[model samples]
Target: MNGKKFVESHFHKYLTEHLNAEIALNTIQNFDIAMNWIRSTFFYVRAVRNPSSKYELQPRMDKDLIDRKIEEMCLRQIKELQKNGLVILNGMNLQTTVYGKLMSKYYLSFETMKLFRQIKGSETYLETINTIVKCKEFSDFVIRANEKGILNQLNGSPIRFPIRGRIRSNEDKISCLIQAVFGNLTLPTPALIQESIKIIRIGDRLSKCLLEYLRLRQSNDSKFRCYKALLNALTIVKCFHAKLWENSEFASKQIRKIGAVHSSLLVNAGKTTIKSISETDARTIESILNLSAPFGNELLLNIMITYPTYLLDISLKSENVIQVHLKQLNEEYIYIGSHTVLIVGDSLNNLLLYEENV
Candidate 1:
């Protein structure tokens, strides 16, 4: 037999068995309503198969009529079942303990048949039902949580810091930079260890400088100016390091690997630049400029160190250059005025030696 004929034969057989003398004579009308309801649901599902398509399921009088009839039939059946002590309805809703088990069994039997047909056609009815059940469970959990409880759970959680740009000294800044560069890939364990080593070395030096400045018997204004400069320099260094790391080929590769595993990471990276740029302290701007001028020159050189061909491109041009020695690195440092910017290869010893000279 053809598919449509087979479906009709089975549907008729089901109605014949269910519509017995024990059921009300009106049950024939209920059976028709139930069949129509199933057909309408199937039609709706087919309409939504290609969500991107312009096609839509329009409301029809036939569908509405069938739905109303089904509701009425179910209500009547519930009433009859309750009267016979086969089920119970408290107020409007059916009591699950009395009617739920039987209703579920009926639903399962019908659904299993529907699923078999769906599977024969290479569809996923069972999977869809399981997904719906999972979604419902999650929704219930979310709805039961109180706002205060949710807030409490989130209060101590770490905020995501957007790492961007370069900086001279902050550990947090360096960490952010490292994350930006290597965050997306399975970085060599040794690379991470090396980065930590660099951070600790830089952090120790910065701490020492800050401590000495703090212990000095300078006037309040002088001390405040020194403190401000130190803090600003640190913040800038951190930002710079984070950006440098993000732009590194190693970091980019890592990010690509991460993107392969988590689709959202690539999307987020494209959408944002630096994660965060701490506001420079207004009071420390001058001090920061003074303390950071030398380091900034060094950083600018470091940026172009890997690309030596870009060195001549960084030299400052113009009328007056008799006094200042312009060790042309890249246009990266030209805006910083007369400060000596030293570009060195990837050698920590060289970097340390240059800093000592400054």
Candidate 2:
């Protein structure tokens, strides 16, 4: 057969009819490349035709044709992922947000894809994929724990705790305690004092109880849920505190003046929440999309290192730079600013700047 005819025949007669019959038949939107490869590879390897096998393959199974088909299938799947703003690579689904930092990238390896196809039928394979996608480290922890027989007696029962009661008074009590301790002590920056207060707050007896519960949780499956809930609550507290510190007026005018010296400091750090971008800034963002980006702690560190004179804002900062001097908390907040550009990240280093418009 000629090249065009060969490609067309495989696509229509084999690919659509054999590999993707269910998808083509139902018009399903959520496409998973690994799952599709698993089903298709199984169909190709079978010796006997099942009731579902509607078409007979050409007697001579050309390996090159099969390889090309798989490649095209992967490309189509990747296109779908791209459209959804997700990335999948090397049998792994890369996280969009890791430990509270944002990253948008995907990767997939040929060998890993082939291995997934081979093992897709295993009972644990799907579970393993689900676990990894949710949190690879957590999945690995569970797997290791299981191998050690830690889960042998697990009934998957829920664990309950009075979380609401514990958290309700945590903020006020912690704040009062902070005020009592550091309220008397003078500090250069109120931000630093606030951070100190947070550190102290985390060390409180109640917080210690939560940490202890998490530690003891490893021995008992019944406590896992409670432990996780407590851990999540504590994390939220930390994030909230960090955000407050980021947005707080500098402890003194001297601090603010010092911060203003930083080349690209994000003044009014968390005041403006960025959801959508204008066409102008969107264009600039597109150019930097491929540039290495930092997430979570790394992003925080980048902000600190690049803008040594400034605070790390919890929210995403605006790209626009304002030349006018900013007033204290009571003053009008302005979003207009020049794009302050700087290198960010220790590993995946990239130029950091704000988007202006499309």
Candidate 3:
């Protein structure tokens, strides 16, 4: 028989026989209700698979999507339960409520049966189950058992299947299971190894701060200290050139270009010419000139020693005698104010430096 037909037949027979029988062991009335709900759910899913529907446009049929659908159905059931005053929402999602949980368990059992059959012949089934068990998350044992049963059945229902020996302790059992499954798996490639190492290094640094904060109970003072520490670390790391700047050609070119401009301008200005002005006045004028220039020329060095970068604008504005108009390359006024300086074609860093000097 075709795969789809086989699956449909098995699903129908299983629902009518095994599932109904299990439900009947509970209250007969609830058995009927649950059976009807399960049947309806199966039909709804089958209908969704029809190419004529909009639901078919959705992505793949994964476990997460199935879980979500089951949750939605459970929520509807829970709402009915709540209306009858048998249950409460309690600010929880469907999966967290009593009625919702019952429905989820039933749905999970059915879904696991389907998945077991689907994965039966796959070479990775045992490996996949081993990984799930090792993770030890919710429903791991149930999933593994179902897979094992299906695999055993597929292998001709052998009277004496090979029994893997269990270890004496739980920790040993988990370790042995992992080793048995993955010991033969090949090591990662060099590129993957390098990436993993980088991730581990970053994680380790973050983990140290995390542990310290956790141990201190993250009090207000502790939090503030952590924040300050992070800022200081960022400053130190940002200043480090070993990993990024590292004698780069770009850095060398920028230094050479700026140094050449500084030498040419300082040479033309002549040492004797600057000697007449008082040192302080010379420094102040140089700062003002840097604020007015497009580049961090000799003017910037003088400004750095004479005036703080923040006071530049205030000092310039106080000079009411000079009306400064900042203009663009086309001589169009971009800004007009007292002591405003026009800088043409300045890089963002150079502009920032000028702003600081001002």
Between prediction 1 and prediction 3, the one with superior TM-score is 3
lDDT of 2: 0.29
- Candidate 1, residues 140-227, lDDT tens digits: the string is 1221122323222222232133323322223323433234333333233454445544544443333333223222312322312233
Q: Candidate 2, which segments miss by more than 4 Å at Cα?
A: 1-61, 83-133, 143-358
Q: What ranges in model 3 sit over 4 Å off? A: 1-224, 236-358
Question: Candidate 1: worst 10 consecutive residues by lDDT?
Answer: 348-357
TM-scores, all candidates, are 0.17, 0.20, 0.17
lDDT of 2 by residue, 1-358 (tens): 6555311122323332222223322332234543445345544444122212232434344655554554565456544433333333333332221200111111222222222222221223223222122321111111222121211211111211111222223232233223323222233446435644554543332233332333233223332233233333344333233322222333211211222222112223321211111112423332333223332234333323332232233333465432322223312333232122221211222112212121
lDDT of 2 at 56: 40
Between prediction 2 and prediction 3, the one with superior lDDT is: 3
Candidate 2 backbone overlaps, count: 21
In order of TM-score, best first, we have 2, 3, 1
What's the lDDT for residue 184 in model 2? 25
216 Cα displacement, candidate 1 (Å): 6.5
List lDDT for all candidates, in order: 0.32, 0.29, 0.31
Which candidate, 1 or 2, would have the higher lDDT against the true structure? 1
